[model samples]
Target: MENPIFKDMLVLELASVLAGPSVGQFFAELGANVLKIENAATNGDVTRNWKLTTEPADTDIPAYFCAANWGKKSLALNFKEKEELQQLYKLVQQADVVIASYKPGDAEKLAVDYETLRSINPRLIYGHITGYGAADDRAGYDAVVQAESGFMYLNGEPGGGPVKMPVALMDILTAHQLKEGLLVALLRRERTGEGQLVEVSLLQAAVSALANQATNYLVAGQEPKRMGSDHPNIVPYGSVYTCKCGKQLVLAIGDDRQFRKLCTILGAEGMAAIPAYATNYSRVQHRQEVNERLSQLIGQQDREGLLQQLQAQHVPAGAIYTIPEVFAQPQAQEMLLRNGDAKPGVRQIAFKVQHQEQAQLTPPPSYNNYKEDKID
Candidate 1:
């Protein structure tokens, strides 16, 4: 077989929980030999027992850890130990990259910071994922960053207090950005053979992921308001109507053409003549009016009928499918939302990578089981 893209890569991960370890996992999936070094006292990454399950054994199985920590070799070491520190320095010398999310002063205190590690290996790519930017002294957490970045401000219904997301979206987003930074540094090294530092802060990453919302705020001086599943710039562009079948349909009419098509399909062509609803800009201005009209028109239609009507008009529309419905969806399964067999008998439910093969979803390893390697 051909060699993997990251065949020459070796990563030393001193990260706990999601963000930093997630960076290592991505590299490992790309064929890097990633070694995740955790503290022995912690026993392993604490995400191991986060999720509660019915079976008692499953709790200890660390299903949470299994999500993003696959394909990595685990080693437990006490950084405070002189011998362990020495061994870690040696490992750094041989590694192509070092991933860490230690607090600002903590890495230097432990002597594992990139500044210290770079002295041992000039070609090592040092990946630092932190809560806030290095320049800012503020510490970051998912909810706090969400609030600070103005993301939470626009998350819920209009007039509702900001609600944090159910998942660590900002954290996961930072992981992906960190991976990109690492890969960029790795590519740069291919030419200069000189390693560099790569840093991703949760706060900045979350702000970046806000995309146009942030742009509108900064450029257009518009404060983003929560529309409560409604579109800010277009009418009929959110959870439009719930059907008799108890399903919610998200309707998106992007432009005037699509809006006209929707009007025809819903048998409300007269709505097209409304001066305030005639253009995208006007529709946005009178979003409340449009929503009320559209709701009245489609509220009585069953989900199946609405889908057929909307789709036939070539309007961008879809049902807000439940998590279960997504799995049952032929297209979603075909694209491999559920993936991997790294754990032999245990199934792996990995995130889908676009245009790529399934991830190596191995079972979460026993505490420090990977330390029996030749490197140690």
Candidate 2:
């Protein structure tokens, strides 16, 4: 296997929870030496205490903490202490990159703001994550941002109360944005020999993620509504059909050709010839009628046979799977990782990169797991 891309890079992670630490985790996976700094006064990252299951007999580390913090060293310090603050400053001086997720003015209060640290190390790439905009002082948790950014308003069934996504989608999207920005900054620093500040907010990320839904309202003057599992623009694209055996399958008929194939398979050649459903645009205009016809036809067929026939006909279709069913697939097994054979062992990184040696998975540390070594 080849060596990792960022073997010699050093990252100082002053982040907690999901978004900021996730960026550090990405660097760590690429073989960067990431030192995660947590405040000793607060028992380290808040996620360390966010227990999903009861504390195991062997480890007090929460699964939430483990998910985003692996393959990194931990240094816990009280910033209020003169000695510890000095030590942290020294670490900043040696780092190639620094990432933090503090509410509005908290970074300056702790003396870890980008401007202060940049003065110490001119070539240091700094990344800042916020809940709202850089100047907004409101707390920017994922759910709140989702609600504020119009994401929640577009979610859930028609005529039902808005529902927040079960996952921290805004945080995850922000992490990706931060990761991309930092990588670009790192590349630019190599050429210019000067680092820059990169910033991402949960609100910004949520808004950008609006994609076509946002465009529908802005460009077409069509405000979107909750359509449950259906896509706003595409007809039959997000509808889940129940088979005779009670299994659910989702169809994604992208074009007229795929629609015609689907119609042929369902013995609805006459439906396919109808002018109202002849093209994707027309079908979208008559989505209820199209969906009703497809649902009635598909509901009579067995899922496995229907899916096999759909695949053979080049129609995009898939069975709706539960979480366990998804994990049971070979593709999913290849993506998931486990540290050891123990029952509640460390959940390894869920992504993979080809042609690189797998990094050794490290369990998330307890508070102040590593003592500060004097920086030269």
Worst 10 residues of 2 by lDDT: 342-351
For model 1, the stretches where C-alpha displacement exceeds 4 angstroms are: 53-59, 334-361
TM-score against truth, every candidate: 0.90, 0.94
Q: Candidate 1 overall Cα lDDT vs. reference?
A: 0.78
Error of 1 at 138 (Å): 3.8
Reference-based lDDT, residue 264, model 1: 87
Model 1 superposed RMSD (Cα): 3.1
lDDT of 2 by residue, 1-376 (tens): 9888888788999999999988888887788888889888997888877885567644546777777887678898888899989888998878999999988899899888999999999999999999887889987888888899988988899989999998899999999999989989999998999989999999998899999998999999999999999987888898999999999999988888998999899888888899999988998899899899899999999999999999999999999999889878987777554566622322235656789886665656666777657321
Full-model lDDT for every candidate: 0.78, 0.85
Clash pairs detected, candidate 2: none
Error of 2 at 132 (Å): 1.5
Alpha-carbon runs more than 4 Å astray in model 2: 53-59, 342-355, 372-376
Q: Please provide, for model 1 over 79-176, each residue's C-alpha lDDT reduced to its tens digit, 9 standing for 90 to 100.
A: 88999899888888789999998767888889999889999999999998878877766666878888888878888888788888887888888988
